[model samples]
Target: MSASSITSQDLSIGQIFQNFYRVPDYQREYVWSESDAKGERGEEVEQFLKDILSEFEQATKDGAPEYFIGTIVVCPGEDSVFDLIDGQQRSTTSFLTLCALRDLLVELGETVPSTLAGQIAAQDTNWQGETRERMRLDLQYEDASGVLVEYGEGRGKNARREGTRSIRNLANAYDTIREFLSVQFPSDANGLRRFHGYFTNKVKLIRIETPNVSRALKIFETINDRGVGLDAMDLLKNLLFMKAKQSDFGKLKDVWKGVTQAIYDAREKPLRFLRYYLLATYDVDAKLQEEDIYDWLTRNEAQTGHGIDPIGFAERLRQSALAYQNYSRGRNPAGGADHGIYNTRLLGGSAVKTHYILLLSGRHLAPDLFERLTRQIEETMFVWLIAGVASKDYERVIVQAARNLRRATDAATFAKFEQEFLVHQKSLNMQMFRNALLRLHTYDLRKFRLRYLLAKLTRHFDVLAYGEAGRESLSHYMEAKNDIEHILAQGADDDAKLEFGEGADSFELIQRLGNLMLIEASLNRVINNRPYSEKIATYPSSQFLLARCQAAPLTIGVNDRITRAIQKLDPASSWDRSAIDRRQQWIADAALEIWGVPSPNPKATSEFEMLIPSPNP
Candidate 1:
């Protein structure tokens, strides 16, 4: 459960630490919205400053409190070095405070250690580094971005602005301290001198040294909970440190950053991105618990397995993902389209359930027919729900059905085979695909319908038809225009309407086909601005007229014909239970022909058994 603690070491603030605090690419990106920073601290900071001022009077009367100003945590390393897990904020703030003090000290003609103020101003080292070139007179702190921007800029936008204001406040605090020192310590140099003495001697940093990575991580978490929140990248970096093999860590870390950055910048959820990567790389779902994920990565299992080398695995995974993405883009130079949308969704490590099914379908059916079937299955409202919700299970059943369909297509009597295959079955095989399809069908379209309708209305009413032609010419106007909702919902266009209809919300806007389409360019653009209400206003009347125009002799209902066919297929049992009767009769007809068996009564055991193909004489 635990590893022995490694040696503990201390790292000075001046060291230029390279590759020491590097974040893995698989980690979540820095995402601090403006509201987060000032939301809580706005009041607390004001109180703290007032308390500090109040304490100043008491401090002068009662002497300073027994405690130092702040605390920093230092986790020791093997050779007198330490990783700055928590306390980057305090350290960086202190560094800036010292820089300002040092600058003020020089202006007061005070002696410092060999241009000490210059070291703080240098950009090469991010304070955590030890080298002279990377050295800073102030403590270095890295934000989520892991870039060495100045402390003021390192935090999120609001924090950056707040930090600058805090510095100005500090300057004023020092100004007060300068006057205080002048009266209290008459010979003292200035406020800078007073601030330096107060911090260098009065400040105390609580250092904890743990040899084990797990305990270190636990400590990291505990400390972060106390106001120093670690970014996702910070946690992921710690994980990679424990998970990655020494040799592969370098390259894999680079690849991890590349992969994660792309996903993060594109606004993907961390868990979803991780799941997608794992599925693509190892053909595995993120079904395992968090502990199991840690164990798998760190080789902390009973086998004493060295965990998967995150870097190497990540590099290989990146290559795989890139290949998959390139392929998914349907832009392969091989002069072929992407196998199918199904293949794109089911990209995985195993051929059994991956794009191989697409290959099987392409080999057996014409591309146009296959594409039609694909669009029918995947583009339906019901199927898309399965994809969006239960993707893995959906993929499994879809692949299975595609496999079965492919097998059936190669059989004799292609039309009957197709018809039989399309017929709903009461068996588990049929139920699974049916369930997947139904999930999409009953999906809530209320979220998306109005957004689409509104966008279309805007394009037709606000821009195209209304702008130049006006309402009178709307009937004659026609133009190549795209679906407003579809383009906006898919994030394709800028003309999307924010408000679609009354009582329609964002979720409802997501489900409609009108919200999902792009107007083709070849169509007329003159009618693009016409309102959908007006455009389709004549359809009902036209349909009424068409009923008269296309009147023909009456024909028997198809269900009656199907019932007659069913009676011929099964004569012994009385037809009842509409579902069973319909399905059983269809099965009897298809199976009898496929297996060379004679049909029997609907209620007879022979009729039911004959529905499934017989294993051979």
Candidate 2:
């Protein structure tokens, strides 16, 4: 944190738009709902209109009553622009309102206000340095694709509806406002004009401007505290306490404390753990969102056995939370890192923990069988993750697998479930996995995922050459002080561009899996953007086999596997686009085996009831 400067000013909606505002790339998409909106989502757009109109109606003829539309936090940027941090929902909605009013005035054959047009869009420079009129509410996120500009300028009729989430939501918000305004004012141009005047002037908002986005967010957090999960967990616990007799309060308290402690120790959200426990252990027909848990629990108390045996439910949670703590830390019951726990934890994306909904359900399985199950689950799951399959399909099947595990009495019963699990992934074979890897570009991946993918590929090859010692040597990029080397440099110079030029596609080609390798950062700094002919000497000493094999006469831990792996490449020859393709093909083959889900046995098919559930959506 740095020494920060802050200022607050009360401004009307119209005056607020005087200074340029931009939604940064890091900010989330416009997700406000028109209907089914509650709490923080403005309780439906109609409520926003009704409330403001109500405030306006309360005027005593002396002056119109000012309606405070809440506060916005922003950080100042160059050219009098402010990088909007908090309150984009309100600001974006207000901009849409202005656009709607302008359109209404035009539709009613009245003169459109030039000031209103300025509020919607102003002069700006495109990335190519060409001057153009871009929307005032510029959504800089990749998925937005200038949706705000298209809609705000009345050019959205021909715009694509099946766009990304942000585009769809922005369009919906604009239409919702436009429709609401039309219905409210009917065809009266005067009523629309008066409302627009009142909206631009009377609807006031407070702006908290800070020096930077981080500091602005820090101040925003100070003003507003977050405890949604904690509050829900507390409420659930109190409900249990209220139901229990006074004599059992102490016992219940002990159970609750153990549950919370296990979760806290595991550094997991307590509510998520509890919710997952229910989903894993039983058949939950409904998609159990966090907010829906309380009502669901209260309504189905006796059917689920939680109401009659609060203590028993608490005990189950306490036990599962402890096991979950182990799983979260990539550990088995013996506190070891085997059973692919580390690999499971390393998988990228938010839904990674959903597997626990099954893992905890099968806690009673024998240790060796449990390890096999973990491996099976991760192997199938990782393939799905890499293939960009929707998680909803995976989660539903995982829930059913957990229940099937609960019904398992022996190794054969568990083995039957595993067979079905493999059979279910019949579509996710080597062909699909290889094709998915073919499209992989490291630049498209998140930071952690990119590292995980490279590190994983490096580790697998390294282990084959260097054995167990290879795992110990990884300091990311599979060695200490190494960087993810673009074997073909990212330089945009004419010679660099012509190296593997596919015209416009050449730029993206450089980021593909084939063009990248792991090299020592020290060596990399020297030959960072150098020609392949100049950079090959440094590869001989590189820790990564993937890079080391590229150079000739490899002597460090040389083996048949390393030799066979690099059979096609000739270090004496020049590296170019063709070389990148061959290297990527090698990586793609490795990926198929790494993420392969084994085929089901011919005889094992139809030997038992198929327990894998069909995906709901």
Candidate 3:
């Protein structure tokens, strides 16, 4: 052996990065700080700063140079480089902090220390007498492979958004660190300089280096649960190693890395992944919680086949993670656009992530069958939301259905699963769906549900009518600023009332599902206050086909979907009460089909269809 056991050195943040790091592809992504829709920052990232700032204050008063943060385990590698086995998250944050400090110091007009820039990336003449440099942290993982270098080169903001969760987290962490620095220093340049000095020189962590990856991983498993502890993900990895034989550690670690990286790339949580895996593989109906994930896995190791074949289980998990990543990115097994998979994300990024249980349950099925399952799951979720089915009730149905879904390995079985379980006709009443459609307004959960509904509606027609959005992913619609457009202005003018009648002035009419459509926010802002006559012309400018369908000339295609729905709408028909009813009725008819709700009253369809004029006869 190189030594009796291993070597350890306590080093400050500045000292640790003196040698560059390459985070092996198996490590988790930069997740110490994640920004979600709920406006919550990563608790650990925030706490990282809060705790450090407390130490910074005392260290400043005491003029101390060593305030320990945590530990990092690594395997020594070629040429002053190290393969980071543990503490990539903390190390990545340290690298980012260097970037933020330099950027913020420049923004605040403080002289950046020569050492700070050198820590991020060293500049020196090589043996050939030419200048060469490299970033201190090199992330070799997919998803955000080149992002660290981009930050090092001072182009962090320009990092592309390909729906890569790691890039988003990295960008968010940089901004968060910059913000923390600004808040702590305010207008005092001297205070800012002092804080930077303390951060680089005082913030310390223990670096553990081993001769090999296996040794480093073992060392990591030992101390990771203590002091700025590792997340459930790390502990689970340790659990996998514990159950496997010595000869299989490398294989187990390889698959485990793929499992974790896939989940991280998808922007999903590891514990969430573990919980869903348990459900899809073992107890789909058990009220498993995320916090209880490790405990559940340990208890059910034998039942889940993990104890029998831990390597095989990891392989299965790797497959599930790959599927989860595809579903997260809105791709089907065949790598084609699956609206069913896309709509869940378009519904709500993380809120509707549980919808993946169905995806995971039937992943081993044929591509067409898997596609059918996703579509059915998407429809079931919509119906549940529309029928005002309680979340717990919806969860119950999907969870139990997922257990049976794994058995639906063929077309016939999938059809049976769809009919017996996914079809929610009995639970969702036609009239209930109709009234729910009428009652739809921006309130309660409706804010997100309404966006999801409108986005789906626009996407459905866009694909059906023109076949244009076929090339555009749901992300284009999702990332783009979308607004819930009100056709009738809320503050009714005299012209609006006279053109549409007295009831058109009512807030209820203005907020109705029929009157509302999805439009790009920029377009909405321009026409938002205009009257129907003035706004109808600008509807053609909207990115949304639904919004553009107001006038006949807005479209040129003779596609039968829109033509039969309304054979070239008249350019002269102003936005009016009759139009709102017709639009609402159109949506109600589609809603029944989309969500698989029971048919509306037969007479009602006839009454609604009459609003669309007949062809010359």
Candidate 4:
């Protein structure tokens, strides 16, 4: 291999595009937009334009020095061409701005600079067909290419078509440039000329050229080391491609493209998925950091007698990506009733990523065993979260659990694995879990957390009391919009205060989980702060356990714990502090049953030791 040569030089807009620049097929599309989804001016694009226009205005009186726009890194290719490694967004947007200026010059009957007009489209026989006019800045994807070609020809439209986000964004950028120029110059040709000269000459970029793609990408990483400007996954992808033999590049690229498309909605999917993949596939320790994943994979591949080939590794990544995607979307790759239920109930929350890593690592297990393990993980996480376990503690426990679970070879091993690792480290067991629930002030939790608790209760109530026939799927309640209502209203008026008794500590009771119910948000406003009699009258209309508060005879059901408790509470009685206390105790008991914690086994020893020193010590 030839030694890689690196050179950096300041380049103006005109000088940068003088040579052919091609965005490789593996590159992401033109994702720059004029405005965000909210119709607000895009931060990056607006800043770029403002900076350039301000520089142009200043140059009219005092000649401005070169304004540093950003950096561009490219690899020298065959026949004086270059493959763009970074700075595509900046280059593409600049090209669009030039095209807009060229068109405006022609529209005003001013002599358009031939060099400026020539930058829009270049005639190249190197293009597959007979000599054809192509955009100077060629994009990888069809939608962006089409928009670029149309815009370069002065026929671009602002209306979005049924296409990818890139296409819409391309069109939006062109329109943005045109509108910006028109608004800044109005009908003055002199202002347009002045702006054009400054944009072409003053705006600058540090062009870094390397002899090979690998070297260029290294420079790309070095330049973006301080920020997430370059995704870690993108760097890993380039590394994998660089490692593969030239003969296998096409095959490896195809496999990688398929894997990326499968998880396109997941931003930085490779970084996350690959970490879990390595943790599960190898016998790594519990502290497997995400940043070390690439180096770990490389070291593992270099090991004697256990090396993974590039193509085989890529294929495994493809398969694992699909499984990871399924788990992320709460779909069961291994179809079963329990698997479905576990995924549906536990998959949509803040702690979902922890579960995803565990599930992804154990995806190869039998459906039944996988379901059992899923429940174990969910239960473990529930205890940890409710106990307010420190983040570091939770991560340590979960990572260790993932390592142990991934190493399990069969159902027996899996069962034993749970027994060993699922024990509470510090304050994270049934006793602590129960205490946490009893002391949990619902209002103290963020709205989403409170809603999650109520949603879980709603699901548990349906299964325990209603059975299959009267079962109302609280999946919607869990996943959708549901209001958390205070049974004893937060701002109870004088009438409601008198009904509940005057001396009652309404504030203390109002925040308690026992005093809360999940009702449709639409009904909360209507039933707000009513007397206990009126509130109980509205209960029968609800699908949740709140409806069981009606005077009708309680239905005979299997696990009627919560429903029976509600049945015992008299609607005619004042909903005072005493009522709140009774309901709070009932809720604490139900929570224990809902999120079951394993009892200590005589044969098992604690696998995890808490880092915190005991108070007695």
Candidate 5:
């Protein structure tokens, strides 16, 4: 590191706002959360204001006549401009204080002067210097995007969206400060004059000069340190820089950056950055363990599988990112593509769960079968999608499902699950699948790596999942109650009986897909009310449900296609043309390895079990 001394004058809220100081183009967007620093903005703001107010109150009580809220930073900056590296928050709050003062003065019918210290109310002769000059009535301000904008009656107009917009909750802090200002100065002309004296004459801003941008950037990083936190983009950015050829790096970076920027700019926060990252890079299949995926990201364990060199992995990421970008932009690869990952929020709903479901559907089964399973899983978990979910439990299910599949004893066990899945219909299978995942997620989130849990909790997935208001509610809920009920319960009046207790009369009333469909819903109401075998045999809608699922998209992997198809066939009836066609094609395709011959030749039948497990066995 090169050493150079840069001098910049301490600047006030007015100065910073006048220039609209922003994170530099090269700087990462604001990734800090107070929680990341082990602090709460509400508590921090409350204490900060209380301290300032206490100082002011004591100063007045002591009859010292005056005190000001002022602080100076000695750091680096460019010639005439300096970054507010040290005092951004304080400076912002103070500016807000001034705004509140301006609002109050206007309400009070004061004849304000058109200059600093005199803008809201006339400046006193006692306050005649830099504060006076800087606080002038017509001071313009900058925005978070570093755009120089005018600030007059509409200072809040067209404010650029950035990460700190959420911190605007601190506006409550401004409201409190304003109330104190109003209380300190009485309403009468003489008393109001006293208030003006305290505000204009008592509020002083000090300036320190700084000399270079680089030094200022470092100093800013130090004083307002948001030390190492998991920024998903950082890894991707590093990968792009390190792996992309000099020739393609710029284009690749631009594409990746553009996608992230579009998300953040549209969403107006950095959380979307994380959302896009997961959608673009994270792929989870039933055969892949969640812990394995997490390990892939953090420990580079899974990345080592398939002998995937860093260069090769980076190439794949680049391809995937490009594919995602195209899908995001509505450009089809061959005419159609899946943007389900990008469009679905990660919250309580099973988008991530569905992702794994779909992944497994595709990975273990052929593309056609995978699509079918995906549709079934989605329709079954429709309620989860609509009701929204608490995230911790949501991820637990996601990770565990992958873990379970990765541990499968052999293709047969995997085939058995697939056979059961098709026999029962995708909806019923998915309901059970999600229940399994939820149980796992709950266990994993609490007991797994604390570091990973923390990162998962802090991730940007929520921005897409819960959204702003929902995010707030979720935070409040988490802070207040550590757990969220995964199952939506039946109303008290419901008469249906259940294993645990009285259940909802209708599936609509139940939340858990497992409880609602497989056991409790009207579709399975008879089954749950009766014995399992009787219900499966006599249920009026069972065959219709399976037929409907068969028509839907296939979502299992290439390997599972034969198994899925065979599971759908009737052992007693003459094999239909579709089944025969599928069997014939299966034999010809090189993709089918577990079974060489697809026909019912005795040898083929024996070998078929290797590829497709019996639903009963």
Candidate 6:
């Protein structure tokens, strides 16, 4: 490890970029196009420019103090160039702002200050007397760098118009700065020049230059620990690159890139993925904290036998990331071939995060065994989530299951593992699940969770109606723009109040699970605040089982104890508290069967039946 030197000094933007800073190939592309004011990035381009100009505007009366922007971490690289380890986005935006201002100056026929132009583009001459035009801040992406160089050279008319995210963002930043300055100065060359002077001289950054990349990465991590921008995943990537051999660095980079892109594609947090990965791969016997991943890796170096094999670890990480991505989108990792779709549908959603570690670790199982395990895990999650089981206990069970799954070499072993760890657990048993369902009311649940439950029930009823499963899963319906509709309108008009008696208790009955149906948003809007008779008449148009049930009676049996309870009621009949109670009982009975809640012992059933309260109670 190289010794690092850290110092903080306020340097103007021009001085910082003029020192020939280069964003290396491994660095992330410019992502500061959006405003930090929107809670996306730090110090947006417009705000940054406005702040600098504000200081400049106040300079006449009070001689403005140096405006501190933020810190930038750089390391001395080969050939007198500095690799930007941090603050690339800020530095890149600053350069673009300067270029836009310089172009505006050129358009006004003012002498573009040589120093300003130098900061934009540096001219280098070799012994052959050939001059090469190099951008002061060379970005990793060629198209973006080209935009900066072309615009900086006063060729704004010929800059690249369309390209990658970085290119488009750079161009947008330039246009924004140019337009803002043009409006603020309004063709006044003197005001523009005065503003430029303040910008290049006043706006400051604490530049921390390091001796090497290793030291630079450490300093970068230290500085950004307090900020939301960087986390353990970013630092881990840097550490992996630092620890890997020079020859293996390229492969490590590619794998890390894939892992990041996969997680991004999945819309998952990188730190969360890393924590899950650690939990899945290592049998920690407890929840792995996000901040402790790197430390755990350091302490468990012997697990890999040799020093941490970045390539091997990265390959596993990528595979796990792919599994997570597939599970997130309700698609199987094995391309949804064979019975993989069943597993995908069974283990997809926000509630499945509890099962992610187990699924990820067992991703390599055979198709049949994998699907079986997925079903068990899904059952466990469904029971635990709906039953309101303690999250800590849920996590512990899943973690233990994951560890056992990792050790199981065959289908029989995995089956035993599931029976021992999940199926046989008291907290996840069918009876508890049944008891929980009996207590649930759609009105008491979150809108999304309620929708999910109703959607699943819809699917279950659909399978009974068709004698086969439907094409859409619970996740598919939830992901679609489906709205939870109250069968009894929330707000009844005068005629509706007359039809269905006007009482506060009647309104309260409308919120229960039996009165709810998942329907299209547009249809829900159309039926909004309508009478039950009018709403029931529209049910024939809906494709969902719950809605279709209102068209006619459909007796679909799940078992001897549970059957499809939804039935068409007379549209002209008054929908009162009794009606709501009947529907709630029907839905609860179906739910008990749907969630696989077991019945009490035969000997105790008569006593239990007497003790069990009715749905209304």
The candidate scoring highest on lDDT is 3
Find the 10 residues in a row with the least total lDDT in model 4.
608-617
* Model 1 whole-model lDDT (C-alpha atoms): 0.35
Per-residue CA lDDT of model 3 for 144-239, tens digit only, reads: 758888788767557553466688788778778878887887766777677777888789899888887777767876785432276566767765
Compared with the true structure, model 4 gives a TM-score of: 0.81
Of candidate 6, the 10-residue stretch with the lowest lDDT total is 605-614
Tens-digit lDDT track of model 4 for 96-180: 8988888787778899877777767777776455676666777765445455667778775534544765776777777778888
Q: Pairing residues by index, what is the TM-score of model 6?
A: 0.76
TM-score of 3: 0.62
Q: Candidate 1: minimum summed lDDT over ten consecutive residues — where? A: 542-551
Q: Pick the candidate with the highest TM-score.
A: 4
In what order do the candidates fall by TM-score, top score first? 4, 6, 3, 2, 5, 1
User: Candidate 3 — which residues are off by over 4 angstroms?
Assistant: 1-53, 59-228, 245-250, 348-350, 425-431, 442-493, 516-590, 599-617
Error of 1 at 595 (Å): 32
TM for every model, in the order presented, reads 0.40, 0.56, 0.62, 0.81, 0.40, 0.76
Instruction: For candidate 2, write residues 139-225 as lDDT tens digits.
Output: 775657777876677765545555675666666666677778888789989888888878888999999988875566565545443
Error of 6 at 601 (Å): 10
In lDDT terms, how accurate is model 5? 0.36
Instruction: Report the error of model 6 at residue 346, Å.
Output: 11
Looking at model 6, the pairs that clash are none
* Per-model tally of clashing residue pairs: 49, 0, 0, 0, 50, 0
Local error of candidate 5 at residue 485 (angstroms): 20
Q: What shift in Å separates residue 97 of candidate 5 from its native position after superposition? A: 1.9
Give the better candidate number (1 or 4) by lDDT: 4
